[model samples]
Target: MSKTILYARVSTADQTLDHQKAQAEASGFVIDEVVADHGVSGVSTTLRERLEGKRLYDKLRHGDTLVVRWVDRLGRNYQDVTDTIRHFMRQGVVIKTVVNGMTFDGATQDPMREAVRDALIAFMAATAQAQAEATKEAQRAGIKAAKHAGGKYRGKKPSFSRNTFQVVKEQLDIGQGASAIAKLTGISRQAVLRIRKDPSLADEALKRWGE
Candidate 1:
């Protein structure tokens, strides 16, 4: 029997494995299994690179359903996302998303349907990549501004390390909640909020403390 597996890349504590499972269930997916990659950066790692993500390749079979929060969860960039989806579709796996309840079925023989499905996949994949790039650019700009200011802005050093800030920024880029990021990084929610509010300032603080 084919099973419906819910896959999630949970980088934060708030969105735990259980939370993801519940989210899928609330979205009407009768998930038989849950596959999650914890503390994984969706913007930096390809689906195949993730420990749990790789398992999907081996665990999934023809006719099984693979459910994700969105298409972005399947890859790190436009090309990667599109390629991964196409690969899975070719293998006869039906891909579904909790958001928008989108479905991509490879079982169809209709040319029109296939074309539409492929187009949609391309659009969503590109959009995901675009969003990631925009977020990255914003953070880069912030860092640049902070560095140029050169000790002009002085305050208490941020509670997060450079690594933690990068992780938080990545998760933010992928649209993860601040509270969730705070919980995962073991920092205050306000700190996460502050980072979100002004990433450049956060970077400057990190630089001041040599974190």
Candidate 2:
């Protein structure tokens, strides 16, 4: 049987994976399994490197269908996203996205259809990469503006414990992915990335709150 599997991700703890699953179900996918990487940043982590993402590789079989909210959930870089999709296609797995109802099937031998499919994949991947870069640049600009205004760049105060902060720092020092840290601590992936990018800012926020 060709099983339908749902792979969902969110960058913030406040976001729920249930909505993604519901979207899939509404799209008529009879999902047999669901793999989620909640509070995981797609900008910094490749799909394969994510905790639940790795499990997808092991779980999906030939003839299976993989469903996602969008192509960005698969990856945020053009090369990474395209490569991942092609890899799955080559393995006889069909990829579907709930948002746009996009489908990528490698089973087709028609040259024209294959070209169109590849082109769509490239476009989506490029768009995802561009969006991620734009978002990062915007964040940098915001931080710079704040610093210029004589405001210390204390990022948002994370709603986690001091121990969670310690674990975040340790994970970052050891080169752990933000998604993994967020998963372990139940904090937003953005929070983990913020600490990874500048622990000092996060520390300042903690101090300000007397944590």
Candidate 3:
């Protein structure tokens, strides 16, 4: 019998992984194991890079079933998300999402079914990518507007700690994009971009805030 695995992700400390698992259970999935990535954003981090996510890659075998709350939990960008799905499909693993209960199985040999499945995957992946872009754009615009209002923009307190900031700096030094850093560190992309733009400013703020 194929094992059923549940993968859950929460981008911030506020989100709870247990809730995601509960949601999956409520959706009637008989999850055999749970793999969770806490304080990890789905917008840019590769599946293989996440702690539990990487384990999932190694633990999953052919004919396994992977369940997620939604496609966005798998990935944010279209290419990355689709590639991950395709990889599992090729491994003879079945992918299913709890939200809409969509399933992708490689066992199907019908060309028309395959085409339809591919189309759905493309549409979902594109939608996820667009949403992430829109969110980042909105954050940028909000910050810009706040800046335009003069000294009223004191800025939100940094969500990350000193160690996290150091990690962000290391990722930046390695030429990682703001989005990728944000996803990996669980910080907002806007914050990652700000840190990338001015590491000194971020450092000063962290010190001032005593983070």
Candidate 4:
């Protein structure tokens, strides 16, 4: 029998921990112990930097199974995730994913299986790292654009609350991505699309405060 330890993480404060826990439980993983890094940014992959992340390395022992919701919970990038998993396996710890039912251990000697698993891990880790980088890039771009564009965005008067439709139009004009604009403006992306679609609102802008 294998002792499973559930690990869960969420990127932001807005996200709830229950969702990740429920997903792991639903996948038939017995919640022996859960280590979570709540409201911690995923950009930092170091275990010591994360809240409960350090506990994972300290509490987990050899012959113990580490169950993660996905490979991303292990680390942020390809090298980090792969290296960490490999190191744990070397330490006699087995790594498992609740979502995929995949396991990585020292006993597996099949070259093809190892290759495939490595490929999958690489792909997912790359995605996680890329996402973090993309978020950083978007924030930088938004700040730069806001300062450059006239009334596009200002610290004094926020872009959305100042002129919702005009801000949307300006963001559209600046070629900012919908999601990036939505996140910066705190307005629904759908609203940005609607404002873009309907030019009539361009002339009659709303007061920018309502439900």
Candidate 5:
């Protein structure tokens, strides 16, 4: 009996991994182990390159079953996703999807069928990559247009509320390290360190205690 591994990737802090896991469980997968990569941008980081994502390359054995919500969860573009899939498939790993019980395995006997499968994988991966590229290009164009037109209405604004900055400071005083403070407050560790670096910043953080 082969082991089953569940991989759930949430690119942004706003996205929840629970939902993906729930979907996999609801579909009858035991989920022996879970590998999650958080705050990792799917566009630049492929399924193999991520911090936890890289673990799959080493952990998955020949008969292990790898599960994901969708192909896009593997990569933002088609090539990244395809390469990741084909590499694992060649290693005798079977990839199972929660979205549609789709399975990709190297056990198929027909060469022509394999070729067709490979081609289809290529097409899908390419399409995913193209879509990511197009989205980036569109953002660039939008930014350029905004630069000429005062750029205010392009996308969502950063939610750097004053309250968040305050929580960051208090957490520091409570003996929370920079990483913990960032994780708890949803701010970056770099930002927390910056505050600790300057006494002036401490003063600012202290002020935030009441508000």
Candidate 6:
């Protein structure tokens, strides 16, 4: 029988595999199994380089469905994401995302459909990579700014942690409401609005406060 497996990557202490699993279930996915990689950097490590990620390649059979929170969970960058998705699609595995409920099926034989699917995959992969790069750049800039300010910087500490901010940002990116993101991340709605307004500033605040 074909199975539906949810893959989660937890890169920080604030991120939990259980939370990801819960998110998947809440998104209406009836997952048969959960596979995860802890403390893995999605931007720095390829999927195959991860221990559990490798298991995904071996355990998943044709006709099985692979579910992720986002396309970023599948690979390290645009190229890696596209390649990994194509590899799985070639094996007849259907890839789905919990965020937008995107479904990519390789079982179709129509040329036009295939072209559209391929284009969508490329766009999503590129978007994921671009977001990752932008976040990294923001972090670096934050660190540099903090170092330059040195002891003179006395910025107010952020009400949210790095992980909480990330969660809020992800939800906001998917068009979630500020109140919803605040409830989900256990922060104030105002804080979520602040982050939504200027994510880079929020990130810099965390870094400046040494969070």
lDDT per residue (tens digit) for residues 1-211 in model 4:
5477877766542333566778878888787877876545556556556778877778777889998877877667667777777778778888888766878777668999878877776777788788778878887888789778853532222224436666767888989986677777776555555566675643334332231
For each candidate, give its TM-score against the true structure: 0.70, 0.74, 0.72, 0.63, 0.72, 0.71
Backbone clash total for model 5 is 4
Residue-level lDDT of model 6, residues 1-211, one tens digit each, is: 9999999887653455667788889998899999987657888899999989989899899999999988988865998899999999999999999889999988989999999999999999999889888988887777679779784443557879998988888899899997678678887666776787789998888987887
Model 4 Cα shift for residue 92 (angstroms): 2.8
Candidate 5, superposed: residue stretches over 4 Å from native = 152-155, 159-161, 172-211
| Tens-digit per-residue lDDT, 66-155, candidate 2 | 999899988798998999999999989999999889999799999999999999999999999999899889989989998999987766
Candidate 3 error regions (>4 Å): 151-211
Task: Go through the candidates in order and give each one's C-alpha lDDT.
Answer: 0.83, 0.85, 0.83, 0.69, 0.76, 0.85
Residue range 1-211, candidate 1, lDDT tens digits: 9999989877643556666677789988898898877667777899899988999999989999999988877765888888888888888899999888999978889999989999999999999888878977887777777779883534445667899999999999999997788778987666677788889988877887877
- Residue pairs whose backbone atoms clash in candidate 3: none
Candidate number achieving the greatest TM-score relative to the actual structure: 2
C-alpha lDDT of candidate 5 relative to the true structure: 0.76
Better of 2 and 6 by lDDT: 2
Q: List candidate 2 stretches off by more than 4 Å.
A: 157-211
TM-score of 5: 0.72
Q: Sort by lDDT, best first: what order?
A: 2, 6, 3, 1, 5, 4
- lDDT of candidate 3 at residue 107, scale 0 to 100: 88
Stretches > 4 Å off in candidate 6? 152-211
Q: Clash pairs of candidate 5?
A: 77-128, 77-129, 78-125, 78-129
Candidate 2 CA-lDDT value? 0.85
Name the regions of candidate 4 deviating beyond 4 angstroms.
Answer: 152-211
TM-score for candidate 2: 0.74
